[model samples]
Target: MSSMTAPHPIDDQWDRFRSTLADASQLLLCLDFDGTLAPIVEEPDEASPTPENEAALASLVSASAVSTAIVSGRALADVRDRIDGPKTYAGNHGLELSRHGLVAVHPVARKRTSRLEAVCTALETVLEPVPNCRIENKRLTGTVHVRSVPRRLRPVVRRHTHAVVDRFGNDALEVSTGKRIFEIGPSIPWGKGNAVALIAADLPSETVPIYIGDDVTDESAFRIVEPDGIGIRVGGDEPSAASCRVESPTEVATVLDWLGSVGVDLLESDTSELSSVDTSSFE
Candidate 1:
């Protein structure tokens, strides 16, 4: 899962999402970082999933009929570093897709590295006058890192990013805004939703997809899903495309625990129902 623009209640919404997973033949747990699992940080590199969240997700993945993915707009390696190499990582929207044993590289990325390089070049030139600002190349994206910059300079930074990218091409590159972080990337039509949809069909069975995320980038996941699939937005007290919302990353973990519980409940209930049924009649 990716992120969204607005905020919504991510807590107290677990039951709303349980039907999507109850009795599901398979469950795909798709998640986002930065406000979803890990709280946003001044330094992107410093953002790490809390040990509890990691352990919970690890446990869920180990459970039968479940798979996991950490999808983020952050570069693949960077996300890998944070989650420490979880299976099924999709980085830079859907530009890079990888699982432990399989990998899919977007063809556009091969032709588009230079475009990112060009954006970096332009960023270096445009941001030269702005002190306390840094331009970063994530290979697939360019971030005008202003985390260290004073709040007053944000407008100046945003203006410079728009001006530089406008110099050439169409909307082939994107500028995404996050908590004090603004990024530009190749204008490609891929994102978390696309990743989730692709991964969903490839699972061994037709599974329920539950996406968890916080950020505008995550809206991609919020938009794509079948009738049985669910998008769990992690943020504010407002409404969104996501069927339900939770308040924080901790709540996300809580909801996941709830999902595990639901699966257990379903298994137990099925067992009890079967026990009550007389099998000799059919035999």
Candidate 2:
């Protein structure tokens, strides 16, 4: 595990990463939503990308050297609705992929569809009594977020949440911890790692990857990049997966800004080209 804070600003690292693309034409850029791109809002629905971020991401997506995708724990519909789908989006922890106008589909996750759906359904009962708690069913996973739960009731919510997922049989489902949520999905062997693998295979990057994320799930991505790539973990952990650590969302934005200015040479870029790569026919 490396530090979440880059040895230098993100732009510096991004410049280094971009240099690797000098000879390469293909590029795969995968970003996690929520804590990564946008500030984490108390209410999930209120979470929207800021104007600056929207512009930056729009530019990033359009970059000639890269094909960007937002891989998130969110559902296909939620991600679609949130990001206003068009670009590549892997929802439900990469179980589903939606590109441009294409319909969402779960290729790597369909195998465990039945198990995951069943678990989500059962969890509703357990969480029904938890005050202010919400069970988000993503078709491929169940997100039990206590963001809106009163602070005093958080413990009760957590206990009940764990017990509900436990009833599904641990092996059949993957229970993950998040900022203020418990994400349960098919015990499928995937996460941000699958997203990275998908992008790496498509981009043909020989320089490996440099992934920056601020979540436990991002660790899976850190593991995949390995010696070939750089893993930057945001926040902290005992044996962190990130090579560098950055403290807050504001810091992340700073890194992105730097990347655009010097790293990716994207400060004065346009989204016309990136949007031209019609992902509409893909799902």
Candidate 3:
């Protein structure tokens, strides 16, 4: 596994990252909710962004050169409600997206909602006897969380979860593992990478894409932005396409705070330049 030293405010590495963003005509700042913006918690519903993090995001959103979006595994409305802002949101692992009063759902994913729900039901029943296993119904997808399950019983949990998913046939649905959780979603080519690509397609040609996340699912997005953009992994030494790393959500906030400050300065500079433009010729 590749590892990076913990990021600090005065780190030269962070300064270089800021320099990249400083020259971009537009910045597409994509973030993951659970582990990137907020610390991972025992209860998914209890996770919320800190005040400092929220302030940073607010500044980024208000910046003329930046477009902020939250791409999360939670349901679109659920994550949107948790973060108090009017930025873009891609939820359900990007199976669903909402931006600027417009919403889009993958047709293929929509078709499997019923099957996913059925799988969720079967997994719930099959794993009910297992302690500390929680079934999260994400509408278009479902997750069997084993983080709190006894380590010895995790194998059994995985077995049962796999059995339930396999019963639906591999073509009907697929299972993906993350941290200590298993997710059941449609067996489609779409993922966070596809979602980020879709979002980036609408931005200016000079826009620089930046994705921050921590999970197996986020690897897809990291690969998507590689070679051309920045991907910052939060709290994991596992092999990943992300080029940089931050120790925890606190460091993630520090990064955001820095980006926000730079974005604000850029916006102000643009305003000042416009104010100085000689408009006398137009009159």
Best by TM-score: 3
* Candidate 3 lDDT trough over 10 residues, lowest sum: 1-10
lDDT winner between candidates 2 and 3 = 3
Query: Where does model 3 exceed 4 Å of error?
Result: 1-12, 263-283
Per-model tally of clashing residue pairs: 22, 17, 0
- TM-scores, one per candidate: 0.83, 0.77, 0.88
Report the lDDT tens digits of candidate 1 across residue range 1-283: 3233343354444454555556555677899887888987776668888777887887787766667888888888788888853568898776788964666778876577788788889889878888778877878776788878878888999988887787743566768786577878767777778888787766644466778887777777777753467777777745456766777787777877776666535422322232344534422
Better of 1 and 3 by TM-score: 3
> Residue 115 of candidate 1: its Cα lDDT?
80
Cα shift from native, residue 180, model 2 (Å)? 1.6
What is the lDDT, from 0 to 100, of the residue 280 in candidate 3?
46
lDDT of 1: 0.72
After superposition, the stretches of candidate 1 with alpha carbons farther than 4 Å from their true spots are: 1-12, 168-171, 264-283
Please, what are the lDDT tens digits per residue for candidate 2 over residues 180-212? 888877666667787667656644333245566
TM-score, candidate 1, is 0.83
